[model samples]
Target: MTETTENKDLVQEENVVTEETVEEQAELTVEEQYEAQIAELQAKLDDEENRHLRLRADFDNLRRRQQLDREAAEKYRAQSLLTDLLPVLDNFERALQVETTSEETASIVKGIEMVYRSLIEATEREGLQVIQAEGQPFDPNVHQAVMQEQDSEKEAGTVVRELQKGYLLKDRVLRPSMVSVNE
Candidate 1:
């Protein structure tokens, strides 16, 4: 190619397009072109920022939902085990309601004792424990006074007998101990 002044000017013209050519390409004036490009870039940046915010929000929602589901699962996991134990409690109630045959009464009583011991032990394993009330000072937080009696043997306001053993489940009380207090 010859190094001509006209050729160089043509190259320069191609590099730096005229205002009329630019207006024709985008169908806008020079000022409008600058404004449109800026607006377009701003819109794209806004869309990208909004998309990132939406994704972060989705992830946070998923984490919260998962935590709630885990809590629900833990709450119901012991339901079946507790249901199975209902029949044993029923049997105990029945045994207390009526006397047994003389022939089998001793064995039945022994069986009941064994069953009660094992049930209590099992409950302890599951975080259940009996509250101490006999011969101790009366405390309303853990002990429920069923009857008050005058006794010379025990100090006044001391528990003489336990009517029904109270139980604790974990750190919370499942039942308050029923007791007779010497007044």
Candidate 2:
């Protein structure tokens, strides 16, 4: 072949090789881009799933807390009414302590005592309890120190007497005992 023709053929061959290299590079770049896009989408999906799981967990915790609060409220529903009735119970106990000589009066007192016992039973069934303060060690949490007395028989900081009774509703203190503490 002529020199010009040979040069043209060489140029054509180089162009063909360059085109094939460019096409191959383009295909590889396209595949790499597709993989990158897939990775980005997978990360976004995982993030959304984690957020949903967290939200669901938070909702479940909130529901459980609300249920516990509701149960607690129900358990203590009678506390206020029982607390208000304490004074009446005290009066009943005081009346029973009075002495009467006549048979008729004694019979009436017995009836009152029966009623007082029934009332006490009902209160006890509902978790109302009397705090035992007389002759016990003085505790600031359940006893209110109204007076202090120096007593030879009792130890210091002991409860000498309970002036007024204290009460508990379940585990919670409704009232603290009014007491005289030995000092």
Candidate 3:
């Protein structure tokens, strides 16, 4: 072969090799771009999933708290009205203590006693309970010591007398017992 023809043949081969390399490089670039886009989309999907889980948990907690609050409200629904009626009960008890002078007075007292008993029964049914104070041990949670007296017959810290009656509504104290404690 002549030198020019040989040179032309070499140049054609190099051009073919360069064209294949350029095509391979373009395909690799497109593949790499697709991989990067897929990775970005996956990350976004994962973040959204985590956020949704947190929001669901928050809603569940809120719903549980609200249910507990509603139950507590229902349990204490009549507390206010019961507290207001305590004074009326006390007056009824005081009225029943009056001395009767004649048959008419005795009948009136007996009638008052019947009405008082009815009131007591109704209140007891609604969870009203009398706190026992006299001769019992004084407790700060259920009894208020208004007077302290030195009493040798009673043990120290014992309730000597109940000045004013205390009452309970279920497990809660409506009024603490006003008592005189032995020192």
Whose lDDT is greatest here? 2
Candidate 3 — which residues are off by over 4 angstroms? 1-25
The list of candidate 2 runs beyond 4 A from truth reads 1-3
User: Tens-digit lDDT track for model 2 on 2-109?
Assistant: 999999999999999999999999999999999999999999999999999999999999999999999889888899999899999999989999899999989989
Per-residue lDDT for 60 in model 1? 100
Better of 1 and 2 by lDDT: 2
Candidate 1, run of 10 with poorest lDDT: 75-84
- What C-alpha lDDT, on a 0 to 100 scale, does residue 146 get in candidate 3? 100
Tens digits of per-residue lDDT for model 1, 1-183: 566988998978886787558757767566687998999999999999999999999999999999999976675555456446645755775675566678578687778878877875776676666689999999999999989999998899999998877765555565678999998
Q: After superposition, how far is residue 21 of candidate 3 from its true place, in Å?
A: 4.6
Better of 1 and 3 by TM-score: 3
Best-fitting candidate, scored by TM-score: 2
Worst 10 residues of 2 by lDDT: 71-80
Ranking by TM-score: 2, 3, 1
Candidates' TM-scores? Answer: 0.48, 0.88, 0.80
Task: Score candidate 2 by lDDT.
Answer: 0.94
Give the Cα lDDT of each candidate.
0.78, 0.94, 0.92
Q: In terms of TM-score, which candidate is stronger, 2 or 3?
A: 2
- Quote model 3's TM-score: 0.80
